[model samples]
Target: MDQQMFCFQCEQTAGCAGCTGKKGVCGKSEKTARLQDELTGALIGLARATNGGTLYTDDTWKIFIEGLFTTVTNVNFHDDTIRELMGRVHEDKEKLAPMCSGCGAPCGKTGDYDLSRLWHADEDIRSLKSLILFGIRGMAAYAYHAMVLGYTDEELNRFFCKALFAVGEDWSMEELLPIVMEVGKYNLACMELLDQANTETFGAPVPTEVPLTVEKGPFIVISGHDLLDLKLLLEQTEGKGINVYTHGEMLPAHGYPELKKYPHLKGNFGTAWQNQKKEFAGIPAPVLFTTNCLMPPAGSYADRVFTTEVVSYPEIVHIGSDKDFTPVIEKALALGGYTEDQPFAGINGGRTVTTGFGHDAVLGLADRIVEAVKAGDIRHFFLVGGCDGARPGRNYYTEFVKQTPEDAVVLTLACGKYRFNDLDLGTIGGLPRLMDIGQCNDAFSAIKIATALADAFGCGVNELPLSMVLSWYEQKAVCILLTLLYLGITDIRLGPTLPAFISPNVLSYLVEHYHIAPVSTPEEDLKALLHEGE
Candidate 1:
C-alpha cells in the first residue's frame, strides 16, 4: 500500500513507522507535515546556493531558523501556519535562485530537491539525512531563543545552511561522518551564542532552590522554552496580585537572578512537559506556552491554554508579536488560586531541588571535584539526564539514578532531572550527589564541565570517569545527542525509546562505532556499567 504523507521528525511517530495518512500523534496533519518537509527542502536548496559563493543576508538566516523551528515537536500544530511558512521558504528560495529563471536546459543544480527523495532513500542515507534534519531542527530552537535576546552569530547561521545542504547531497558514511561532527561543532557555537545571550541579558543564574508549592491567590503558570515570554509575564504581572510560576522547561528561570528578583514570581508548579494534562487540570491558573512541547489541549483545560512566540494550537489564546500578555494575566486573576498556600512536592516527595549549577558553577568547583576524584572519594560521575516524556519505559531513569553507587555523583539537567531530582541522594565530598544543571539547552554546561574535567586530568573526555545515560523526547535532545557524538564521546546509553525515525541499518552503525546502547532494565545496565568500571 502506498504511504500517505508524513513528517515524522520526532521520537513518537504513528505506529513506530512514520506519521502517515492524516493526523500525527501530536495532531499535526499529513498535509502540514509534507509542507514542513517542503519548507525544509527549500531551505536546503537555498543553503546549497549560498554555498556556491552567493552571500546570504541576515534575513536569510532568520528564515532558515524559523523554518526549522516550525517543524519541531508540538511547536506548530496548525496547518495554516505550516502552509504559510512553506510559502515563505519558497519565496526565499526564489530570491536566492533568481538567476536560474526559465533556464531551458533543466539545470537541476539550482532548484529545490524534493524531500521525499530523502524519505525514500537507502536506510543509511535516510538515517544521515534524518540526523542532519533533526540536528538543525534542534539547533533552530536554541537559535530562536538567542535571537529573541538580540544575539545572533553569523558563523552559526552559515553552518545551518551548510549542514542542511549536506543532507540533500549523495554523501556516504565516510563523507557524511565529518559533517555529522560539524553539526556538533556548529551546535557548540550555537549553544555558546545562546548561553552568552541568556547570561548577558538575564545575568548569570545562581544556585537557587525553588519550591513546587502554589501559594494562595491569583497566579499565572508559564511553560515552554522562551525566556522572553516569561520575562514579559513577570513584567506585566508585576505588583498585580497575580503570581507567576514556572512549568516545564521554564523551571530553570528560577535560577536566573533577574527572574528570581520578581517578588511575585513564585515557584515551579509541576513536573516535566509530558505531565501538563494531569498537572494543569483544574489548576485554576492560566498556563502560557512560549514555545514548543505544547500538546493538544484536553477539553477540560482548553480554555486555560495561551500560546505565544512560535508555539500555536487552534483556538488557544495567542499572545502575538506585540508580546502583550494581558489575556494570560486576566485568566490568572479570574481563576483565583487556593484560599491557602497549597504546598506541592516533587515526584519523589521532596519540597525543593537545587538548580543553577551550570558549567560555570561546576567548573568553579573543579579543584574540589578533582581532589575528591584523586582521593578516591568520588569514584565516578554519571550524567543521567535528557528530555522527559510520557512513555511507559521512562522509569528506567528513576531506577538508573536510584541504582547508582554512593561513590558516584549524578549530574542532571533539563526536565529529565524531574525523574530523580527530588530523590535525596546524600552529599559526596561535601557536594550534593544530585546536581541540577539548569535546562536542556544548558546541555552546553555539561559539555563544558566534561571538557574541563578531562583537561584537568589530562585525558580524553571518554577516558574520564564520566558516563552519559540520556533520555530523549524531542529535537532539542536530538541536537544534544549529535553534539556528544561529534565530540567522539562514546558509550552513551539512550532511552526510553529509540527514535522510530532511525532505521535499523543506521541504528546498527551507531551501535557498532559509537557503542551507543539502548536502556535495558536498570539493574542489568547498572551491573554492566559497574563491571566496566571495575
Candidate 2:
C-alpha cells in the first residue's frame, strides 16, 4: 500500500503502528496531517529564531504553545486554520530574525526544519525524539490552559523552547534522552501551575455529584479541559434561560466552587469524547469544544458543532477571541433542547457520577486513609485513569474496576473514568471506593496524594501498596506516564497497546529499568499486584 503520510502518536494508530493512509483513524485527512507537520516545522523554526538572541515575549510564548497544541491529535482538522497558524509562526520568526530574510545567502539557523527528515530518521532516534516531541506537545496543552487563566511560569515557558530546539537538532540518543526526561521534569511544573490556576481561580474543588439528566430547556454542551471557557460560558448564559452542561473532561468543572455556583451550569451531558458522534446526533443544543478529544463531526450534528480555542474543524462556527458565545446561546435557544427531561446514564447505567477528588480533598482524608490501611480496613489502592478511546480492549478498564475488591479504593481522573464511574462501588473507611482526581492535568494531584501518603506511612511511593493500571490514548497520557517514570515510580501497567512510536530497544530499556508492562487481564494482573510483596 502506498503511504500518504505517517503518524503514530496515539495508542490506536493503525495496526498498533503508524497511520499511513489517506485518513488517520481519528478521521484527519492526509492534507491535514501535512499541514500539522508544516506547523510543527514552523514552530521549530520560530524556536530557533527566538533562541538566536531574540527576546521571548508573552506573545511569543503564546504562539509557540498554540502551534504545538494545534497539532495534537483530534484538536484542529482544518487545513486553512493550520496554515494560518503556520503563517503566524512564520511572521513571528520574521520579526525575531528580520535580517535573515534579506540576507543574500541565508543560513539554515533560523530556517524552518523539514519534518520529513525527523519522520524518516533511524528507529531508535525517532522513538527518543518522539518521546521529547509528544511529551512537549502534551505539556503544551497544560501550559496553554494555565496561560489562559492568567498564570505563567517562566521556567515552563523556557523549557518549551528548549524542548523544541532539541527536536530539530542532530543529537544522539544519549543527548536526546536527557531532554526527554527533562520534558517530564518540566511537565510536572506545568501541571502544578495549571492546578494552582484552576484551584485559585475557581476555588478548591469539592467532591460534587453531577447528574446525567439534561433538563427540559434550552442548553449548551461544553467539552474539553478548559475551565476558563466553561466559566465564561456559564457567566454569559446565567439568567438567560439557557442551561450549560459539561461533557468529557469538563465533568470535573462541576466540582469547582465558582462554576458550581451557577445554578444553570446543570449536569454532565454525555460520557467520554469518543462517544460524541453517536451521543451528539440530533441533539438540540449546540456543542462547544475548547480542546482536544474532538472527533470529526457526523452530519447530523455538524451544524450544531462550535469550536473555540485551538480546537477547530472545517466549516464549523468558531467563537473567536472576543469569547462571545452568542452564537452558541442563540443556537441553544433555537433548538429548544428536549421536550421532556432526558434521562442519560453513565456506561454502567447509573444516573450520576462524582468528581473533584483533587489532592486537597484526598489529603484531607489522608490520616483516615492511613489509619484504615494500618487497621486492615483498606486492602489496596489503584490509580486507574487516562484518556478514553473507541478501542476494543478498553473493556479491560471497565472489568478491572468491576473486579476490584471491596476493600480496595479506586482513584481515577481524565476521561477514562466514564468506563465504570457510575457503578455503585460503595464506600471503604468513609471514602467512596471510587475517587475522581479531576482532569488529566490533575495527575499532579494524584502525585501529591501519593507523596503525602508515603510520608505518613514512612516509605517510598513504590513501597506503598498502590498499583497504577493506566489506559493511554493520546499524547497527554504520554507526558503523564513520563512524569511517573521521572518520579522513579515503577511497576505501572499500561495497555490497550503500547505506543506505536516506541522502538523495541526503547521498550526493553523501559522494561529493564522501570518494570513497566503491558496489561494482561483483570484477574491475572490483580493477583500479581495484590500479592507482589507477600
Q: Highest lDDT, which number?
A: 2
State candidate 1's TM-score: 0.95
Cα RMSD (Å) per model?
2.0, 1.5
Candidate 2's displacement at residue 505, Å, is 0.7
State the lDDT at 189 in candidate 2: 90
Candidate 1 lDDT by residue in tens digits, 1-534: 146576666666766567777787777777767777777777777777676425666478888898899889889887776777767766766676667645544545467778888888887778777888898889999999999899998778878877887888888877877787788888888898899888888887787888888999998888887887888888888888998888888888888888888889888888888888898897988999988789889999999999888887778888889988888888888889778998898898999877888888888899999999999999999999998877678888998899899999999988989988889899887988988888888888889999999999999998998888999878888889888888888999998878877878778888998999998888888777766656
Candidate 1: segments with Cα more than 4 A from true spot? 49-53, 99-105, 109-111, 532-534
Which candidate number maximizes TM-score? 2
- Candidate 2 lDDT by residue in tens digits, 1-534: 245588999988999988899999999999898889888888887788777324665578899889889989999999988999888888877877788776655456557888888888899999999999999999999999999999998778878888888889889999999888898899999999999999999998889999999999899999999999999998898889998999998899988899889999889988999999999996899999999889999988999999999999989999999999999999999999998999999999999999989998899998899999999999999999998999899999999999999999999998889999999999986789999998897889999999999999999999998999999999999999999999999999999899989999999999999999999999999999999556
For each candidate in the order shown, give its overall lDDT on alpha carbons: 0.84, 0.90
TM-score of 2: 0.98
Each candidate's clash count? 0, 0
TM-score of each: 0.95, 0.98
